[model samples]
Target chain A: MNNQIEIQLSAKRKEKPSFSDLKFGKTYTDHMFIMDYSREKGWYDPRIVPYQPITLDPAATIFHYGQTIFEGLKAYKNENEEVFLFRPEENFKRLNRSSVRLCIPEVDEDLALEALVKLVSIDRDWVPDVKGTSLYIRPFTISTEPNLDVTPSQKYRFMIIMSPVGAFYKEGMNPVKIAVESEYVRAVRGGTGNAKTAGNYAAAMLVQEKASAAGYSQVLWLDGKENKYIEEVGSMNVFFKINGEVVTPELSGSILEGITRKSVIELLKHWGVPVSERRISMEEVYEAHQNGQLEEAFGTGTAAVISPIGELFWNGEIISINDNKTGELSLKIYNTLTGIQIGKEDDPFGWRVKVE
Target chain B: MNNQIEIQLSAKRKEKPSFSDLKFGKTYTDHMFIMDYSREKGWYDPRIVPYQPITLDPAATIFHYGQTIFEGLKAYKNENEEVFLFRPEENFKRLNRSSVRLCIPEVDEDLALEALVKLVSIDRDWVPDVKGTSLYIRPFTISTEPNLDVTPSQKYRFMIIMSPVGAFYKEGMNPVKIAVESEYVRAVRGGTGNAKTAGNYAAAMLVQEKASAAGYSQVLWLDGKENKYIEEVGSMNVFFKINGEVVTPELSGSILEGITRKSVIELLKHWGVPVSERRISMEEVYEAHQNGQLEEAFGTGTAAVISPIGELFWNGEIISINDNKTGELSLKIYNTLTGIQIGKEDDPFGWRVKVE
Candidate 1:
């Protein structure tokens, strides 16, 4: 664990059962890690304080300009009740990348990881061991500069908040039906689409609701330019299976490079699966489906280990895949990743970093 | 003005301001008008209370997803010390347009206008009489469903806050240089380009800062498809003076249909100036400049009445308009528009709505 987060416990810490009846983001631990950064102060005043409300000026940049970036990783309890973070360093690195794009201050990668590990360790009991559950850690930094001008904040607040999450999928790994949102585009090139900033999600909300109202669980966003190339499936990165070849969209300037997407690629490669990252257009996918060449599709993200996409309705044209069920490859990947995370199997990639 | 707003002031009011030293958004007037909406209670609790901190659940949809929309207008004190709102009806109409796009509930237009007028009346001294100054009115609504789901919020909050704003443009509107961002695309077809939502502004912030850092005042965005067809100029709509004919890019799905753009078109048409809206590409504009057929270029918006384009730098190419000054036609349009706003000229188009 990063030793940087020195705790100052809240006088209001719950006495008992705080560890048992926990739901994601509903209950918080006693303390939250905070750090301040400014051009004058550099990075100073790192403290773990009582979880409380932060009184921000009404003109704070975060309120007006949305200059915020966040990272989500989890601390898991293993079979032996030992706690470990799955690739904590990766979250920090990705957060910094998001920071650079949003013009927010980047963090010292090592210190961020340490803070997350320490905070999770302090609330280790909050990490549920009842299979496929963990303690969700939110490392977010907001532009705290109180100004009306739309510039990057000179001063900022970096915070880490922990929440106890139950099963991420709730119903386990189940196949989902998504809509091809040809009428709406999520992001465009040279935009904040690649960054984990708040605006990208905001831009997608309107169409996402439309898709959901049309009776779909998620949305498959195509490239904004031609509305053809597959970009993202709602919040997750997508993969398609065609004739036993696993194909996913290459990370372009407009697509987020998801950590789960990366892990899946590496694991598939290690297992000698024919995986390729290329630009797969909508027409090709539709034509393949029509010809019965399409096997399956799924999405990958932190909240969802793997969500199978069973069907797609593209611009009023519907296409159903084989069985409308979770594919074999996705099921295997989900199990293997979950196994490594819960200490049920040896992590050959050394992905888990154990917290003391 | 919309007359649908119901006001219930709190038992407090800030003392009158001297009105001279007021900075934009620094001092909020007393008695802010607010309303809430949900599926059950379509809209309720329309009240005007003392300006105070709003108590929001930490998981408010606006905090997590940027499902917020806002409008910027101003109340001007005419010579008789009477407050007047310039085309507030347009803002109310536009606000609903933005709300629909962001999947937020719409407010009654009459109610919105009435509430604004009453609030401005309560804080009349905040309306600055100084040239190029007025009491800035920010009417905004945010979704507060307080959930992590990416669906449209079941509940929404609509509020109006007023602050005295000096001249919006720091430099008196002589002209400004803008960088042509071929690399970054602002909005694509079926995107949130036409809406005055928070996400669009957040998406534009980094690019704007980059252009400023690169020594330009603003950015000129291109279509996301080919990066060729000129869209809006950052936040405002663009117009060109070519061979004595006023020209603007046609409102493709990506271009924001600016109110000022329509006003300018109507004003130009009234004065017998030939105007045409068509697809104008960057290559064509540059070619016109090279052939000396491009006379001038300027931008139009609520805040920036008219900003002349002095220089455009696009991918190592710098194109300069003649004389690096505001064009003649631009000055006429600015003067005509402001004259109508400040009640200095004839109200030919019935644009100004008196605050009752």
Candidate 2:
């Protein structure tokens, strides 16, 4: 198989968006990486072309069966005008894992990674140099077979689109208020919760919309079975600090294994802060708040390195964390991860892959 | 809103497939129904045009977030060449219910139904006249906004497509074997199971594929919480007759409220047969089998009408039902429903809607 990716530049380039006024996932770059997979041909004809609309049959399985999966990452530009991607190989690996769960065909990971680097390198100017601004890369796979059957499609399309996004925390990493969801569940064990599939996010919209309408930034989902154990916060994996021990829910096949969550655990262990993954319940969290043992809480994801939780509302009771301010440890970890992500800090772990 | 539906007929009509060789969802008619929805304009511009491909942005919410919902019903032709629809208004009502859960804007149900009747009337010839062949109608709504956010899209497209499909059971209404799912789950109570959304079917693909690989025609999904109580069978609602008592799992918010299931219940009540809907566990089913009270088992859906369960394999224990033959009651119910659907019997319940 030829590893080369053919490039087709856009004849009419789109005007770039202002770096400071960009919203998440709204602005697109000049080009995108695309590849197709067939049951007989595997994956072939890899190319980077001008970003455009895709035409599909009205009965395409992706539009009717939700046989789609996606991964989220970002490309950063340091002060020296160098582009770097933080562990993009991990994103491709997770994409394949999500493919297996969604019953879609997986792609060649090495070739996918190569396509990403080349695509980003071709559109390097789109990587913003401003602080807290980067090129958000979204790699997604969709079933394209024109059939309305509830089975996996024989044809698939894997594409990578980049958008220039401003910082998730526009106001200096301020914390967010979250509401505990008791009525709706995001995912349950033995479901597609662990995989980054489109259905998981679609199943979560109603609850998230309700939380937003209630003036909360996001919803803290409980386990789908008992609706007691904490699962996640919005689209990110959640973590809490209580009585000097940092804990997040163990991945019990129903929670996403967030890359940022994994990196934070590693950073905490390196700094000698006690950390563990176990089943943590909402009752225990509320009790810790009442006992004054809840020092800090935050969420981890690629979109935001750390989203500190300022307040939590459970069953009409509200508790403020760290007096509605960013905790010391949360700030430290955020800065450390962001520093390593861009080329500002020492890369002892070798997580960043340069786009050369 | 203008209730006028614009029409654009296909200039070059394609040859229709032979009725005897027709497959499910593979052969489409010449035209389709479409409507667009926007937050500013609401649902407007209903029209019927030639069947064709739909172009959408790569970042459309339907591709990345799975904000899509669909409904399925069939158009049957009588011996006198009259076309009829079975409980189509109910399908539209459920579509709005699904829209509420997925956060998509609801359509004007009355206008939508009018459009469907008009479209099917234009393509009325596509409704086959064979005994077990009809035109399967699929109405779907998809989020078309080009953004990668996890929130609901402000713009959507609702479309109706028709396909000439052969009988789900080719060689008469024979029984099938079903394997009980022990590992994967279909949905949870607080999830989007009750709604006819794309995600529910997508999540069940892996389990269904595994069951098919194991020589089972379909899978019997248990509850998501305890995995004990019977939930559904494949894409259909399940019913069992134990010791002359016909019972099915109640509407538990996780299982779909099938229209055929409702029709069966009403028919049973009209005939004074012992019928009930309540929580029925697999353990009780196994025990009923041991006691020789498991007389019949079958599934109900629009596609198959009634699919009898010849055998069930649960946790390595295989049990045959009704001597591996279609139960007498199952056949009676199938005949009654299909008879009403195709206008062979008097519409005592007024369930058939003529497309005129």
User: Chain A structural similarity (TM-score) per candidate?
Assistant: 0.95, 0.98
Worst lDDT 10-window in candidate 2 chain A: A1-10
Best by TM-score: 2
Worst 10 residues of 1 chain A by lDDT: A15-24
lDDT of 2 by residue, B198-312 (tens): 8888899998999899899999999999999999999999999999999999999999989999999999999999999999999999999999999999999999999999999
In model 1 chain B, where is the ten-residue run with the lowest total lDDT? B1-10
> In terms of TM-score, how similar is model 2 to the real structure?
0.99
Consecutive 10-residue window with the lowest summed lDDT within model 2 chain B: B166-175
Error of 1 at B336 (Å): 1.1
Candidate 1: where is the Cα deviation over 4 Å? A1-6, A14-31, A169-172, A315-317, B1-24, B168-172
What is the two-chain DockQ of model 1?
Answer: 0.48
lDDT (C-alpha, whole model) for all candidates: 0.80, 0.92
RMSD per candidate (Å) reads: 3.1, 0.9
Chain B TM (all candidates):
0.94, 0.99
